[model samples]
Target: MTPEERSLRARLAAHVSWAATPDPASRTAKARAAADSKFEREAREMHPDASDEHIARVAKHLRSAHFSRMALKAAARRRNSATPKAA
Candidate 1:
């Protein structure tokens, strides 16, 4: 590529990379919301006869598990990001 074109491409890549890094608070909140909805749906399906207190406890447990899974996935990405790529 021409020097000017290469420079422009580099700048664009940097900008895109910076823009794509999610806000941690927003990401966590979104994950939690998704987990909450998922828990509600599954609880409703599997425990139609469950009481309010039991449902609350089950929902909390399920959401926490989902959040923890998300966290572990994020950690794995961070851990693997530094590895060298295959040629």
Candidate 2:
């Protein structure tokens, strides 16, 4: 019930609130769908006369490339984390 106790409780509550919130930048199905849609729109704009199949192929290629890069980065991070740090 002291002032210091109240301050500590407020800090803990703030930290918990932050930790409970999902990361805004984390990838999710919805985010991936949005990205796919954006890529398809861009492809359409670039090749207005292209067939739907071609546009879909282009979007698939773009999405695969994006995922490949993400995988590579994740692998690199895992390797780095596994390495022993110099004292």
Candidate 3:
């Protein structure tokens, strides 16, 4: 079994079911706050002379890249699932 599956099973056996699902507004707020915090923390390393707009653009590019990669993975999974399995 996968490690995640094992971990999930262990969590289940341990009777640990504590997942936090924030509201839309709360989620947006949390995401914005986290982005701001991260930008501030890594400002010097991200770019000693980078402006706020540059940082924002970089963040946007990263987000888009991640989303595109995930979409490609999902599409690949669907394509593989549709093909006939070899014996």
Candidate 4:
């Protein structure tokens, strides 16, 4: 109940509220959905005889791998941008 603690709590609450808002129409959101569907389809095609559980697992793995790769690339881009460029 210190003033500084209250301010921090308010800012954190605001951030959490803002972050929880969903935007289904955003391009990135749509792209992510499309990618997820594509992964599921690809998994199904690759293992036509597999059980639903297996296919779902494969699709989940594919989506996770894809996003992890994207995150790595984004981090690399940020690192490169922050580095001083040679004249």
Candidate 5:
């Protein structure tokens, strides 16, 4: 995997159980907070010469992954609900 993809996966892995979260709004808030925290931590760990672009890239990847996970969970819930229970 590319460096960007690996970084994104690491960020996503840091925050688990996100998909199991029931409320969309709550899940979004959680994701945002986690992303922001991770970004700041990463920035702090980077060399002083590092640029904002790197931090932004990480944040973007995290947010995108979070939403993707949330969407998948919501779809799964919908599908399960739609399926009739066996007698």
Candidate 6:
């Protein structure tokens, strides 16, 4: 291979290594997953009579568990409207 090709390959390898770093947020999700899974299992078990659509709706809310990005943005907009601008 040419020197230019070798240099490009090394840079790409380094970028891939950096990108693969484990994000801490993923670990937090992993910790929460056990509890969340148990909740889902129990919900299905206790409400075997409930419709799939209802279960899916409840599951969506459960999955969010907190303010999502869109919700945050909407909140920010509301706060902005309530605040006075500085001169």
* Residue-by-residue lDDT tens digits, candidate 6, 1-87: 999999999999978876786875674687778766765666677678888776666665756754476798899999999999999
Residue-level lDDT tens digits of model 1 in 22-65: 77567478877876788977776778899977887888887788
**What are the per-residue Cα lDDT tens digits for candidate 4 across 26-63?**
73787878888899999999899999999999999988
RMSD to native for every prediction?
7.6, 8.8, 6.0, 9.4, 15.4, 12.1
Residue pairs with backbone atoms closer than 3 Å in model 6 (clashes): none
Go through the candidates in order and give the clash count of each.
0, 0, 0, 0, 0, 0
lDDT of 2 at 82: 100
For each candidate in turn, the TM-score is 0.54, 0.55, 0.54, 0.59, 0.46, 0.34
lDDT of 3 by residue, 50-70 (tens): 887777776666666767999
- lDDT tens readout by residue for model 5, 1-87: 999999999888756555566777875888778768885666546535667777667656766777899999999999999999999
The superposed Cα distance between candidate 3 and the true structure at residue 56, in angstroms, equals 0.5
Model 2, total clashes: 0
Model 2 is weakest, by summed lDDT over 10 consecutive residues, at 23-32
Off by over 4 Å in 2: 1-32, 45-48
Off-target runs (Cα >4 Å) in candidate 3 are: 1-23, 31-46
Error of 1 at 26 (Å): 14
How would you order the candidates by lDDT, starting with the best? 4, 2, 1, 5, 6, 3
Candidate 5: list runs displaced more than 4 Å: 1-35, 39-50
- Candidate 6 lands at a TM-score of 0.34
Q: Which stretches of candidate 6 lie over 4 Å from their true place?
A: 1-22, 56-87
**Candidate 4 versus the native: TM-score?**
0.59
